[model samples]
Target chain A: MVSKDELKKLAGLARVELPDSEIDSFRKDIESVLDYVRQIQEVAVGDISEQPQGVYGLMKNRMRTDENPHPGGEFSEEILNQAPQKEGRHFRVKKIL
Target chain B: MSINLEKLTITSAHRHLSNGDFSVEELVGACFKNIEDKNPKLNAFLEVFGDWKEEVKKAQKLFNEGGATELTGIPLAIKDNILIKGKIASAGSKILENYRAVYDATAIAKLKKHQSIFIGRSNMDEFAMGSSTENSAYGPSKNPIDPERVPGGSSGGSAVAVSMGGALASLGSETGGSVRQPAAFCGLLGLKPTYGRISRYGLIALGSSLDQIGPFAKSVADLEIVFNAIKGEDSFDATTLSEPGGLVLPKKLVVGIPRDLLSNPGINQEVIENFEKSVEKLTDLGFEIRDISLPNAAHSLAVYYIIMPAEVSSNLARFDGVRYGFHKTGDDLIDEYVKTRSSGFGREPRRRIILGTYVLSTGYYDAFYNKANLMRNLIIADFEKVFESGVHLVATPTTPTEAFKLGEKANDPLAMYMSDLLTAPANVAGIPAISIPSGFSKNNLPLGLQFIAPAFREDVLFSASRKFLDE
Candidate 1:
């Protein structure tokens, strides 16, 4: 089982607040999922290149001229309206420090 | 109940509208009437658009002007995840409850050009996280076919919209089984095209790699029309592929059935029987069928769970409180992110984010995420090998069983994940797959038979699905 401390740390990294009540259950859930996925370890990877699958075949490099101008935003006003706290065109955030 | 809109398919509706048998207004009225009567019981639509008439007016002008596409004036329910500019796209989560879209999804933009009317934003599993719509912050969408049961999700409400005739078809997004599972349970045709087959811009990302916008309709013909309209490359989504040239299926196509995978003990006997019957029907239709083994298929679900959440965490990181979406104030910016997200996301998404963070976190990255990526290769290789050996399509049951009761698997995350087992492999392999309505189970609930083709082979899926429907 993943320790409760580990779950808390994970929740912090994920930017989610894990209530004390959910720590045990989350640990159990994470552990079981890890257990299920552990089957991947059974297959010997050998000297095979670790470049991952499904990425290369689906994507290809399609370069565009750098000189081309980016599409100017027509949605700034609408987007700003959705922000919970905004001043003028900029979204307002709490102090970083 | 005055009109049986449920019996009307888009093909027949188009013919009627074109022949001047009924006006677009009448068609739209009939759909709204169905929504008024059925949506109360079904909970399919989160909010039915009041501006449907105005949109249809434009479509009617197109018809008056002449040379209208087949989808002109077709009413479609948009899944909450797919954006329609200036509309609420909550993605069934509290985080996005009041968040309106600033731009249209590529699919929505394309459909608008065809004069398709947006009926409403349909409900879904929060952030497309759960297999059942029970995870929606709003509430579960009831199955139109069986009100007591769930409409399999995260495309549950979109499926219900079509099933109840609330819309002729719906645009639903899928990361794994969201579109197909719901279509199977609701007895509609659902198609998940190849990964890059459709642009993902304006879609609320679940797993960037696995997600694709798909269509759910009453017939394969309607599915094809909708797909043609919404598919192709977009400047916004770099991952999208340019239109693959059209394909023609061979006269005698050989379909492979991964016998070992289908024979898993978890699959209900009724589902197995229905799947076998579907295979037999295909054989009788003059298609060749063979028992094939996907040796690495067993690890697909595990790999999917790993990769999906990892990508999901990364993709969803954009939803911080500052830019847009739900916000909560705290002493510091870090606390604000934590509180806002914790409050905004529902149980399932929160769980996934944490799980995702764990897998991609330092010290564990190589073990979980890397291993899973490597396994994805083996799984893809298995499909490539099968397709190389004369397999035109791979067939399976869309799900292990028909729709279960709402809340049946809610508490058990593992059980909920199992609901997507058969459907996830196609997304993993980045292939096009469709779920076509098969015979019903003993419980009288609908079932679906799934067919997967090689990447960009949507034509093969369409042909096979159409042929199966004909049979």
Candidate 2:
């Protein structure tokens, strides 16, 4: 079972706030999920080999053209337009100092 | 002319469009008309596109120029996760509620070349985190088959859009059973192609290794057409298969049924009975049915839960308040991230993120993430071992049971996670799997029998599904 402190740590680690109201409920659900999936830890894999994951395991060294595909700043405006706060060309964040 | 949208298949639509039975505008208009009527009731589409008229003009031009592909003027629902340039793709979350796509997803680009019309962005479980659309930030999409029950998700709304005649076919993504389960519930064919088969360039990533954009349609050929259109190595997606290779075909089509994995009490008896009938059908169609052993098969869902969330945690780390989307002012910068994310994301997304962080955290990584990856390696090897024994495909019920009531498993995270029991194995192995609507349950809810093939062997799934459906 996930403890309250552990749950808070997880939330902090994941960069999401664990509001006081949601802590207990999130803990209960996450604990249940962890307990369920923890069965994998006991699945004796002594006889098995851990192959590298995915397409890269089977095939590699694939390459593409070196030339840049898109023009510089082609989507800079479109991307910047979505920023919550932005200057002319930079995404503006609150002052750090 | 009113289009019988429910019965319209891509092949039929193409013939009719070529024969001048109806104009592209009429087809697109009829789709809009149906969506307008159904979406309000079903809560299927999150947002309908407004520029379908422009797409109609392009399709008509293709037709007039005698260069029309089979998909020209075909209206399709795109899952909210796929980015279509100049349109909003929320992925059924409030954080990105107003996040407009600046570029088209590779699948959308391919479909656009064939002049395919995107009807709208359909709803889904936020961040593709849950089995039911109840976790959607907007709302859950009601099942067209039975309004009270869930249309299996996170591709639920895409299935509903197709089932309710909003679109002739739709595109969905699968990390677990997202696409196939909903397709099963909606009485449609759905496919989860080999991972990397479809480019992930524009898909909102959940589990990067497990996620693959797939299609849902009423007919097998339609599903195949959609798959062929979107699948191929992409320069943008590094994981896509490098070589265009021929599908592995056996001299005699042999299907392996791992009976051990299906014996769980969680699997409904009705699903088992229907699966037996499908086996008989496969036998009748000249497939050699063999009972086989996949030692690591039962560990699929457990392995998937560990692996998927880890990737989700990493993949979703980019959603800070500064760049785009909903932002919240907090005490400081770090506080800003915590507040924006906690407020922006829904309960389910937060829970998964926490769990992913937990598993990937230093102390627990060896127990959970490492074992899960090793178990995944074993699962992959088991499938390879079976195919080596001359078993061309693996068979199982697409889901454990028929679609359940809207909130049946809402309170129980464990029960909801069980939805992916059968389908998760394919995703784990990065193989091709298709869900064919086998028959209906006792309550008249639809059921699907799935056939999973070796990596890049979607050809086997397509031909087998066609024969099974007798299309």
Candidate 3:
């Protein structure tokens, strides 16, 4: 079983608050998935490769020229309007310090 | 409504529109009538678009101007995950409850060019997390066939929209089996194209490496038309591939069945029987059938679980109450982030994020995440080998059985996750797969058979699916 303390720490790292009531049930639910997925450890995969690619084969990620096609701030008005809290042209956030 | 929306496929609708047998507005109104009549109990749409009239007007003008395409004025339900500019895309999670899109997804952009009407955004599992729509924040979407049962998800509402005749088709996104599993349960045709085949620019990311937007319809041919409109190169999503030149298929194509994987006792006997009948039916279609080995496939589910969540943890980090979306305040900035996200996300997404953090944590990184990635490569290689031996596509039951009763697996996360077991491998391999309606279970519910084609080979899937269903 994943210890409650351990799950608490994981929730913190994941940026989620784990209410005390859910600790036990959540741990069990998470562990069940983990236990099921642990079967991959039994499979034999010999030598590990330095680089990995998924089924779709391609080279390095593509990059475009440093250019903005739709003049700057085209979508800025609509985007800024959605901010839950906002200041002049910026998203307002809670104090860092 | 005079028209039976369920009986009209895209081709027949196109013919009718061109022949002036019925106007696009009449067809669209019939669809809205179905939505009005059926959506009350089905809960297929989260919000039916108010702009459909404006869209319908443009489509009618296209027909009058003789500029209509096959998809012109066709009504489609958009899954909440795919963005349509200036519209709210909640993704069935509380975190994005009021968030609206600022730009259009590449797929939506492609469809818009054809003047396809957006019916509205449909419901889905939170962050596309769960296999059943029970995880949807709004509420579970009922199966059209049986209200007591689930419409397998996280594309449940999109599936229900087509199954209930609310929309002629729908656009759904998938990370692992979200499109195909639900299509199977709802008896609709669902296609998940190869990763990079459809651009993911405006999609709400679940797993960046595994996600793709797919189409759902009643007929394979309709699905193909919708697919062709949206697929191809896009500068917005760097992962997207350029359109390939013509693919010349062999006169004879071979299909491989991974019987060893299918024979698991966990699979429903009725589903197994139906799968066998589908196999036999394929033999009658003049295609060569062979039993093939995919030794590493058994590990694919585990690999998918690991890699998917690890990516999920990374991808979902953006919703920290800083910019747009649902937010809450706390003692400090970090606390604010935690509190906002904790309350913003539902149970399933929160659980996945935490599970993801554990696997990618410092001490466990090498053991879990790295091992899964290595195993994923082996799984992908296994498909490569089978295809190298001249297998055109791989076949399997889309799910273990038909849709189960609502709340049957809701409490047990493991059981809910297991519903996606057979379909997840294709996502792990980044391959294209389609679920075609195969017959029904004794419950009179729909069942499906899936065919997986190699990466970037959606052509094979479309052809095979059409041939199978047509026969």
Which sections of candidate 1 miss by over 4 Å?
A46-49, A52-55, A67-74, B1-3
Consecutive 10-residue window with the lowest summed lDDT within model 1 chain B: B1-10
- lDDT (10s digit) by residue, model 2, range B180-215: 999998899999999878899999999988999999
Residues B81-117 of candidate 3 have per-residue lDDT tens digits of 9999999999999999999999999999999999999
DockQ for each candidate? 0.67, 0.71, 0.73
Instruction: Specify the highest-lDDT model's number.
Output: 2
What lDDT does the true structure give each of the candidates? 0.88, 0.90, 0.89
Docking class of 3: medium
Per-candidate count of clashing residue pairs (backbone under 3 Å): 0, 0, 0
Stretches of candidate 2 above 4 Å error?
A53-56, A59-71, B243-248
Q: Where in model 3 is the C-alpha error above 4 Å?
A: A48-50, A68-70
The CA-based lDDT of model 1 is what? 0.88
In candidate 3 the C-alpha lDDT for residue A44 amounts to 72
- How many clashes (backbone atoms < 3 Å, residues ≥3 apart in a chain or on different chains) does model 2 have? 0
Docking class of 1: medium
Ranking, lDDT, top scorer first: 2, 3, 1
True contacts kept of 1: 0.69
